[model samples]
Target: MTETALLPGPAVVASPGDFPDWSQAASHAATRVPDAAVTATWRALNYLCAAQLYLNDNVLPARPLRVADVKEVPSGHWGVCPPVNFMLAHLGPLTAGRPPGSEVLVVHGAGHAGPSALAHAYLTKTLTLTGNGPGWSAADMRALAAGFPHTRAYGGEITPLIPGVRYTGGQLGPALAVAQGMVLDAPHRLVVALLGDGELETGAAAAAWTGQRALLGSGLHGAVLPVVLANGLRMGGPSILSGLDEDELRAYFTGLGYEPFLHDGSDVAGFRTVLAEVFARLRPLGVARPQPVLVLTMPKGATGPEQVAGRRIAGTPAVHKTPLKDPARNREEFAALAAWLASYEPAELFTDRGQPSDLVRQALPDPAPRPRPAPPVEPLTVRGEQAWPLVSAVIRERAAAGSFRLFSPDEAASNRLRLAVSGDGMPEWASEILNEEICHAWLQGYTETGRDALLATYEAFAAVNTSLLVQHLKHRSTRTVTGAGGLPNINYLITSLGWRNTYSHQNPGLVSAMLETENPTVHVFTPADTTRAAAILTVMLTGRDRANFLIADKHHTFTFPPDTIREELTNGAAIWPHLSNPGPGAPDLVLASAGDVAARELSAAADQIAAARPDTRIQYVHINDLTVLGQPDTWPAALPDDTFARLFPAGVPVLLATVTQAPAARALLAARGETARVRVVGYRDPGRPLPAADLLELCGMSATALTAQALSMVKEPR
Candidate 1:
């Protein structure tokens, strides 16, 4: 880690009346942060230079800036750069005096200007701490500057897919939620969240803002200071919040119970002073309540070029991206770009050797050791219909040990998780946010912050967070490969499956979509019974950098014994030797099942085959992991062909009863090169409002249908 201390220095102070109309004035006289402002200006220059490289593929001062150097397709947003740098500037001085080893996290919500974040990290040498050696020099900086907005390099957005990033940025509205999760139980830590003003228009962002109600009076011990980068512009036009005056903005946040502090960048010194004061007042005093603060009125493109091509750029929607794209075609625009780059005076900010000067180093926060990973919780022992009850016991145990949280979108009681609710020996163990997006934000935020947590929701509605799921899975996959420590296994307890609901709720497409990605960090566990679910949850809660989905029913169901569960969980599937009828040789047909209902139906089908056709030979295999049926190379849980053959010999007809979509099952079999021979029966329709038993038959997922399908396949010649 690098040793950097940001010392406060003199700054230019402006009166409240100096700001633009509709912007609020500072409450008190401003304090100066000359050093921090210099660092901020230096970072703003880097961001602008990076944007130029991404758009034109050449730096401003470089001689012979040519059309050939310009990228065919310029990418990356530049409008938000000024605010991103502005917020980070003040954060440096705030963390400067903290004790060594204190935890301070900066979660950037605007990721489109990912290069800005990369630039800031590089300048501070935080990139080096993340194991990116040689990133501190001018040569490396130039290399990094030229690579963004290109698929072959850093890509266009900030993602956990890269080392040192704790949150995902391309997708808007989840950073605050992620921040909330990180601060839980760590009263001494400070989590600063920077959200793009335009992103606040998103429903997820609104949900996350109002959802802070759950944080209040909940005994949480961390501070979340949300800095809204109020740049007033989205991608194509003005944001919804951009039109509101300072009073309206203050009222909006105040209505949500936050003590909003207004800041205008025209007075950067004043803004920094207010920001420091806010942190000082909110620093945890061992309180069990949320400390929420908001910074409003951040101008977009505060200090870049004023205009280009006879069009106003700075502080306008036009600045949302590169102001002068295709610079090779226009000599005047190219000249303007060069002059703009020179305005930052980079030579004064950096030493001749390319490293940041002492002043810059002093303005940068020191990097601490990566947070510790979640400890493994003891496995729960309860089985049978008591599976969920045992889960409640485990929740109590984990919550008592601290660092455990449970979130639901108004489905806890429906999912039979009442025991894990607040109180009942599990204070703060559960929070019902009533909105899937909000719940997902909380779950992702909490896990990203180094704790264990789970979200229970209807299988159908789990798709509400489809966008979040995809990004989170990608992030987890990155964490796994990069050894990006500090993330915990994010578990989704998906119940109220499609089979038990009508058309409105009968959607099992999430599983199929997840399978389509085939992400190694994503695992689907359809445990046979409550006991198996308990066992699966035990392993899931303690796992790291993975998305574990446990699909089971909320109703009472049959369960297999512990012995079989132990053996099957090892390879994801195992034959039920006692129930199988292989005779002295291999069976004539094989029956496999996944999920609670599918397992029961398959078991019943086996009994039907035994009674009606005494001479038939049948082998039964239960699937715990749906992905295991695929080739091992494609899926980490996949069973080897030889292991698969042990249950289904070559030339034998196979019938698989699955709760997932038919396509997903077939896709897995196809990956194993068995699709041509295997017959799959799974949820295939928007079910009618019927009894549970009738619903199964309506979709041909019952024992009678399974038996008929099995017998027909068995009778056919291979």
Candidate 2:
């Protein structure tokens, strides 16, 4: 990688009441941010002037201004130029009520700050921002924007994303606080953030915390513009590779009082629909229930990409096919694109300017010449040689010994840690961002911000490991300890081990110290463990007894049209595919995945079946999906049948749930004849299994009782 370092500077963030509010700042941002908007196919011509100046990574060519050359343009990149294609799809003749321009703020890291330079160039009228760059350069756009066009801006060569005005060189963390401030301070304006997946955890946390606090406190008025180009891997875990998951993602945003929606980062239509929904939601809740949303358009990484220091130890999703990029060719494509822009002439850049207007230009006001940051705080002579070397050496040794893999081992202790610095280097907020809480958020956020597959990695690492440990205990323990309520034992193990009990709630990392590789000695009604078991079961037993409750009406599915409730049951059946089918002979039981309607109609259907076939006995049980099935493979094996005694010792029928074909055709089966009856029944249902009293009479000293065999599998095994 090309050697790089962010030119140190200031900080900023979001959340309500975070900074002073004023009108001038809003107007200045509105005007300056939009000037940088993308205008043409290669990147709208108007915004290209600014986009060209962005410091792009060799991996990113889609963005014009990024200083580094990167061959990628994430959906989040739209904040800067609104991807020419996206704008082309939505920007039709800028009709009335079309706020001067695309109201979006392109969020980028210091390494790619040059792009925002373009955002400021053309997006000024329609969009606004707090400030740009990575780490320290994070700014309070609401505060900085307060001063108006006269507002103090950064100095120096315009970075790709940084405005010539507030050129912090490289800092951007604080900028998030600033943007969030704008949303809370100026609730009416839209808040858009353009971010790569790499920037998600680092920048999003404090901002999210601030946003959540703001919403809970006073409710926010504006929208959160998080455009995550999910790129890399998670920082740590079992081999450490979590891509992302919707359950985790929605839970996180909802915790912040915002509902989340994900789309193909590059799908212009899906992106637009999500954005439109976001606007509508934020507009009404404006401060009443201020929900700052995070729109993630991850440029999924490959199945297993190398890990980055300070990132989740897990792998990132594959963004190679995000419609906006081709990883295979991005390296050269972005570099050449950057070089070509560097050769542009001033005449071609602007209509009136003689010299290239393309150079980083400051639309915002100039700042009072500021002082340099203070010297780094050195360790006192009180300690012998700072011991950092010893600590580093020990850490590396442990990592090599199969404890954990540590990246960037060569980084000096001074740099290995995070530091808070002020405008004048007064030790503003410098400190390691990693903590119990941050680690927890990073884990949960990983799920919420990316894809479903990637999250499986994290879950397997965090929760599954503990679950395996639970399974280990299940093998040795005695007596079924039912954790009645509150914290179950299994729940405790998960939460204690940093697995989230509920997907939402607090960052579970804080409770990491609670993780136990071994079970507790105390047997005092392990509620926590039991609760965890219940939660895990909830995930595993989604479709245990679909047929028991969801039997299709012999002729029709239902009296009323299938609505949301019915859909839930049908969807639940998806988890237990084995339970969705019937045997060969019998048509089906009853159709009832329809909740109350399914339950009532199913009962009535049973009565109808009884009236129609008085000779056959029919009684269906509406067992909840989770309550019924343990394993999809064995579920169908449990259907009770006596007239075909080989299937089950009882005679009954069943109806199953299949979203694809529910109530249309029930699985049909024919089996062995009961000894006395010598009649074979075509269908069987587990719901009508013979009661304990009946089992003795029919089993009559048989080799085995089938119920005993099956219940043995579901019950606590001895």
Candidate 3:
């Protein structure tokens, strides 16, 4: 194979290549492909997508499409495209000579800039390689352009279904942290994340900035090269990062412990040179700790029309979206679009078959196959009285295997996980960061990179990453549905009960919110004791492609033996026959409970009810999986009607004591069409510190409250 030259020759007069570069100058040129010509073609494709809105591979002949071809709603942003194109152009060379199985995973932070990314994918024949049911031909390219922003075809943002795309956009800030996680423990891979200036202002992004400290000290095998697209605009206005000068940008990143690299995105050759040097120094093996590199590149709308309707679009907020697209009644703008597309000279860049020309293909790298994850290892089992020992045992086992990581907001030791600390007393497999947001990013990144990890935080503080968790759940669930592949389990251990804290720390509302999303992959577990918690966690650790939320109190708690635990895991609920004081035939009232403290209270409530009303007869039920209460259609864990009938009986009054707010339990009962007969007593934020029993009573969670509520319901009607 011949070595491809880095730069093409200068453009002669009267040639199509005579177009000016991003700097808008002919003198600033490179020796390989002309920057202006490439950027023009890139802009043309972007304009085509914006103008046509909805075209497919079936669209005939690849000339400039007409405004009549436009869809009713043209989606996708134009402003973010230029910088994406510029980044892709510079990125091409980095992957050209990479060894087999080694890949440069590009995490597109600016997801709406899909048009520019698709254009790059098409130009390099990457789209062809990863495309489904489509050959690498000119017709396919046109179809891809046309079908974009359409769900049937590729849509506005990158999804797991797309080949070579590991990250999704649209959600702004997680990509940076995601990129960091993608490269973890994978010595052969490098993740180049392109972040939008607008996304940098998000709270998630801020979390990633601080999370970098954990990443640096993590002893990771891979590195992240974050390229900030410092374009002047976001969607409709100037971005926060756009206001900061280069010196300030450098200082900010430097203060965050990164070595900042500044590059004018308009200067193609300069960026290429700078990129090569950075890759050379950082990409090599044995760099002690892998320090991240942040490049500040300004290339606002570098490929869109410089001016439209006598108003400047490039380098302004106007360029953020389609600038020359009005299929309805704007013929002048349509005509301008035609001229702009003509300048790219698409015919010269692609063959008649819609495939990239040989010259262009030579400049791009072959899309490497997606990496496969290792199979899950066996789970740890502990038939013990304490939950932390079981959790610590697994952490140690996984840490030895070099695939486990734990992130906490400085509560590991307090949570009885002291055994997981290192020789120097630092957490070995866990990092005790004080920021929940940062810990959330670390956990997200680590799991996204194909590792089995856990994020342990106080139940209330978990809200800090609620949006982040939702986005990830979306990404993972999509992959599962699309038959792409399974995502590694993303486990969240929420401990430190609200009963132990004042109202300020009692926020288990995320459970209700998560359940409401109706995400099929979600499994909410409320372990009633250490034995049950161990059983649930073991399954979670060994599970595949599911988002498991394991809620348990960190304090030492009573535990059942191993056999009972197994029975509980299988049934999703357990019946303590010995503890039941039901009457001869069917019980008059069924007392069911979930969560540790709540269940314990219910047990005591059962005894009191039996003592107070000997003829009442009570059946005691303990639920570990909250989903069991949902209708079968909504929850596979739900009991069959016959089983449910046996547990609660048709008209027997049911009293459910739960750890979450009462509404969540009500929602579950409503889903099962049993709302009329069941009464739930759960957390109500008692507002001040009190004894556990006092708090429970204040929140209508005490055995006394539960017993009283059950009697009222039973005595009310026929």
Question: lDDT per residue, candidate 1, 446-515, as tens digits?
Answer: 7766678888899999988887888777666655555665467878989988777766888888888888
Task: Tell me the tens digit of each residue's lDDT in model 3 across 445-488.
Answer: 66665677888889898877777778777777656655655656
Please provide TM-scores, in order, for all candidate models, with all chains considered together. Answer: 0.89, 0.29, 0.89
Order by lDDT, highest first: 1, 3, 2
What's model 2's TM-score? 0.29
Error of 1 at 526 (Å): 1.2
Cα displacement (angstroms), candidate 2, residue 433, comes to 16
Q: Which stretches of candidate 3 lie over 4 Å from their true place?
A: 1-73, 99-101, 121-132, 283-296, 383-387, 421-424, 560-563, 687-692
Inter-residue clash pairs, candidate 1: 5-362, 6-362, 178-445
Candidate 1 lDDT: 0.68
What 10-residue stretch in candidate 2 is worst by lDDT? 447-456
Ranking by TM-score: 1, 3, 2
Compared with the true structure, all predictions reach lDDT values of 0.68, 0.28, 0.66
Better of 2 and 3 by TM-score: 3
